[model samples]
Target: MLRRIPSQLAVALFWLLHWLPLPLQAVIGESVGELLYRFASRRRHIVMVNLRLCLPELDVTERQRIARAHFRALGRSILERGLLWWASAERLKRMIRLEGAERLRALLDDGRPVMLLAPHFLGLDMGGARIAMEFNCVSIYARQKNAVFDHWLFHGRSRFGDQQLLSRQDGVRGTVKAMKAGRPFYYLPDMDYGREDSIFVPFFGVPAATITGLSRLSRLTRAAVVPCVTRMLPGGGGYVVELGEAWADFPTADVEADTTRMNRWIESVVRTMPEQYYWVHRRFKTRPPGEARPY
Candidate 1:
């Protein structure tokens, strides 16, 4: 009962926020982010720790700058939930620009299954919302604890396109079923999901725990892995969702090696935009046996 109070408040807020201009919402979000950076001590610590580990070459001052920018991005993402949830299709389409449209088209036209490899960028949901406008797809879903929030999430994600968001408990079979039904899977495979179905792989040179689902899913479903990322343009210039061509020669019968390859690819993309990758997460929480926990 107590929890529902705040979630109901958040739902109300999302509706209110959705009515504002996107650029104005972004400005407000940046202010909120600054506040979070100043007072959200625990999350700030995690972000700094991640930066220190992942970007060893960067000095403290440089990393701090990146961390600050990241907070601003994170804040914008929070407020942008309104747009994802309540904004009209025309409004969203005008703001979000798409790249590599033809590549995705070609894959769908060829009757090939696809797995959109979306990393944990702050504007990730934006990419999902935009793609939802065009394609019907399946992806992993994590249900929020609060009922109001969970309902809001489900409603917002499904409002744009015909998407089946299978929960983590749904396992690979749900995804395979969806893909077989002709819906591409929007696979966001770059989070730290402890050690079940995960292998120790190098991410930014750290032996982080990562899921080998991409390889296994592709192997089972023969889905083409298409790398997708969304960049929140500066000054609320909206966003850019970029898509890469399908990966060839993937899932080479070695799950560990394939996971490593995926991580390496993510690391390279993170290098292109360090501040946008999700650094606030305790990505290295699960240590190898006999290894000290870094978080």
Candidate 2:
């Protein structure tokens, strides 16, 4: 009942925000996210742990600063979802500021499916939808926890031509189908999902148990792999979605080797904006062979 209550209220708030001016709605979202971050103890600790792992070179003060900033960004992202999911198409187009559209366009123009890799940065859900609308098709792999929430989120995400695949069961098949149809698919390759079918990969010099799905998918589908990220601009203006070069000759015959290479690529992307990266996730929870879990 409690879960349903929040989601029900969220839907109500979504409609309410839609009626407000875009700028005012964004401000309300940012303010709410800030308030939650200031008061949420569990979330605060998760952010701290993520910052500590990624930026070990920083002093305590610097780490704290980054964590606080990251939380605020997260808040803004949560608040903006109302606009992204339910706002009129014209309004959403105005709220987002895009970069690297040419890169994506060029990839699609080549007549090959592109693997859109994005870290769990701010505005990714909205940015993915924007890209999918432009390309006409996008398949994204997502982790599903609750059946009810999954149903709702999938519907919302698909509103902009982005298809959501559940990571546990249908993800691989869904991705393959998208590739065969020559459509771009998006995946977040950073999170740790236990020890099964995973290999030790260096992220920030620590061996994090990373998912090999992206590399495996590339190998299976022969799709071009491209890294993309969505970042929230300072002062709560809007978001920028950036794309980088396609992974050259990726997904060699060897799955483990290719997966390691892909992790290195993700590490480079995350290093560029360390704070915006999703540090609150328990990325290193699963230990390597014969090693103790970090947490």
Candidate 3:
């Protein structure tokens, strides 16, 4: 009953936020996110540690500044979730300024399924919805956490012909099915799932456990794995979604080799804009034998 009550309240609050003007709603949302971050000291520490490791070249002062900005951005993202899920199609469209969309469209025109891989960046939810509207349907692999939140997010993502599949037992099969049906599916291969379904790879000179699902799916379905990112423009000018080159070939006979190569590709893309990447995640939590966790 407690869980059910919170879920109901969340739904009510979502609609309430949706009814407000976008700017006003964003202000409120960011404020709430900032409050949460202030209280969540453990999480803040984890984010700081992650940032420091990824940007070892930066001195303490520079790293702290980046971390503070990242937290603020995260707060904005949290508050914008309701607006993203419930806003009208036109409103959502206006919220972002897209780039390299033609690159994605061109890939789809080739009659092959495309795998869009991105690190957790700004306006991810909104950006995904926009892409699904412009291109074909997208199937995204989402990690299932709270049932209530999952239910809400699933419907929210699917509202624009984008399906959300849980990253569980049938996730791989479902993803492959979607790709074979010529749908563009999305996956974030930056985090550490575990040692079982992942392998150690170099990310910012540190070993990180990276998911191999993208490589496996591409090989099985013959889909094109393309690196993409949504970066926030300065002065709150909205977001720009950029597309990079597609993977020429993936999923060779050796899964480890293929996974490592794929992680390297992701690392290269992330290096270009380190601040945009989600430095809050403990990417090195699951290290190899006799190795300590970086964060």
Candidate 4:
């Protein structure tokens, strides 16, 4: 009964926000994010550490400023989930701007396997929804603890797109199968998942347990890497999903080198849209063998 009450309340909230104008939702989201910035001490600390390590040139004040804006963006994304899941097709099409998707389409049309390198940006769900509206894609997702929440996640993500959200525990086997079968794998490669299939690579000049999945998958499936990113428009403007040209000479002989190259590319983009990047994650949680964990 106790768990059921909050589950019902959460669903009620998703429904309530689903009815509001996106602009109004944006306003409330940012306010709630601001509150989180002030009160969510643990996550706030992780954000700070990530910014500090990744962008050492910036002073403390500047870094904190980015962190603050990050929380606000995070909040907006949380609330905007309603729009992604429940909004009309015309409404979503009008809101999301696409660039260079033809490049991806061309590759897919030619029957070449493709892997979309999607970073952890706030607007990524919106981007994925938009892509799934027309194309079949596969991606990994960590299940939410609450059964209701988990079901909602699966439903929302799969409703608009030919997306198969495989459980993280299921690993990359299913995703590889999807890619081999001509569906684009929306691969999010930047996160600390310990040192199982990961090798320590520098992100923001600090060694992070980075996955070599991109190169390995590409080599395994012969997929071309298409870098994709989505940015939230300020003042409730909507989203921009950008797809880059397919990378040539990827997964070149060395996995570590390829991993480093991947990190370098992510760092470059994150620099351009610093605030939109997901900073709430403990990206550097697993340290180098003897080094102490930062978070």
Candidate 5:
């Protein structure tokens, strides 16, 4: 009971922070992030390592700058989640701008199964919440270690529309059913889950153990692949949810080639917003056989 107090108090702090103006929150978040970059050495190291691996062309100084900026964006994301949890629907709609949404709506209106390819961006949750407001969607949910945080996280995500979140343990079976029922699956497939069911694909010219789930799911469900990327505007401007056009002739016979294409597209988008990408995650943690681990 005593151990839970800290998380409870942290939740309280988030609640308090939500009342402040967005620009003020951005300032506080950036200040907190700068401190994290200095003190959180382990995670800072991970961010640096990711940048070094993915953006090898950038000199050490430039990569360091981007790493520091990423921490700032990450901090803002954590603190601003309070707004998602507690703010009114009207307030949130003003903050999130959705572009190219007609492309998504056209498919959904036609009773087609659509897979929204959402990559790991700092503003992913914001984008997800915005999507929940407009459409019924299904996304994979991973349980957090802290039960208190987990409960609130789930509530905040599902508070808007008829949002259904399936656990990672439930696998894609349940998600497939939900999608077939006309729910767009908000998929995040850019992570180093493991060697199993993942093929070595080129991510930023590095051999990343990428998952083949995107191709498999699309093939299994006959869903159109639509790329959705959320960009966090600087200076507390808010987020832009960019829904890209559906990929034509996706999920080809060769799964490896399709997965490679997915990674390449994500890499191209990452280049556009290098700092906002989630660099703190150990994306290259898994390695091929007999190869040394980077982290």
Candidate 6:
């Protein structure tokens, strides 16, 4: 149909762009990001608001600098996703290096249920793609409004391994069932999904409405929470998927406390690479009773 032309063109462009060298792609992507930073007023405002709330110590100018840098990272991520979608398994493996992978393998070897606590980072898709190459994993994703784009997104992600993509609307029961069956869950729990099944937890000292699914999932499946942080190296340098040691004695009797601990750990990681974090998202959108929304 006529309405699908734009989406078709976008996919074609991504396919074309994937053929270029990474360094050249990085240059073009950053340039695109600079343009977005200047012209995309709404997204720029959201990023600024997030920076203002989360990194209050940074002055206006510093926050602006970080915001611009974040847009550049986001731009690179969008462009590089083409590589993830079409590049060969060998080529992708060469670019994405997994550090501390044994930690995850050890848990699985011990017949333990594993949950990969992947936060929102620019290289999230690349990291997930890399993991999918090695393990038959399960992840939850929201469907895109555009049917053309949605089909490609699902195809790109499911291209490698026996990866299973569950719709966000499918809920935790299906994901829990997957986790119980020895499939490692690539879980991204650091987003504001409103008040349902979420509690107000302090993220960067701000009360963020975070889903309590991490603790609940762990409790139900007895999964070990291993933090997976995917970092995009500067310029043409490839990505590194760093797997941290699994948390011991996690998901205690109190779900609130467990969620708080998860947020604190995510905050620490974001501090290390502020520009790569998903700043464009309205992280603090949902507010507690009597509190105003930040975005």
Q: Each model's TM-score, in the order given?
A: 0.96, 0.87, 0.85, 0.95, 0.97, 0.97
Q: In candidate 6, what are the lDDT values of residues 1-295, reduced to their tens digit?
A: 2233498887888899998988888888888788788888899999999999999999999999999999888888887878988999998898899888788888888888999999999999999999988888999978999998788888888999898889988978888888877789999999888888999989999999999988998998899999999999997788999999999999799999999999999999999999999998999889988988777
* Model 6, runs deviating above 4 Å: 1-5
| Model 4: number of backbone collisions | 1
Over the full model, what C-alpha lDDT does candidate 6 score relative to the true structure?
0.90
- Order candidates by TM-score, high to low: 5, 6, 1, 4, 2, 3
lDDT of 4 at 62: 97
Model 5 Cα lDDT, one tens digit per residue, 235-273: 998899999989998989999999999999999999999
Error of 4 at 63 (Å): 1.1
Candidate 2 C-alpha lDDT tens digits along 1-295? 1234576676676667767765676677667656656777676777777667767889989988787777766766666676766776776777676677787778778777778888777777877777766766555546457665566567667777545454555547766776767677777777887777678877777888877877787777778888888877666566777877787878788777887777777677777777677766788778777887554
Residue-pair clashes, model 5: 0
Off by over 4 Å in 4: 1-5
Best by lDDT: 5
Q: In candidate 6, what residue range of length 10 has the lowest lDDT sum?
A: 1-10
Candidate 5, position 91, lDDT: 83
Worst 10 residues of 4 by lDDT: 1-10
Candidate 1 structure quality by residue, lDDT tens digits, 84-169: 87888999999998888789888978888888999999889889888888888888879887777788778888997678988888
Ranking by lDDT: 5, 6, 1, 4, 2, 3
lDDT of 4: 0.87
lDDT values, one for every candidate? 0.87, 0.72, 0.71, 0.87, 0.91, 0.90
Candidate 5 Cα lDDT to native? 0.91
RMSD of 6: 2.1
Off by over 4 Å in 2: 1-5, 141-151, 162-167
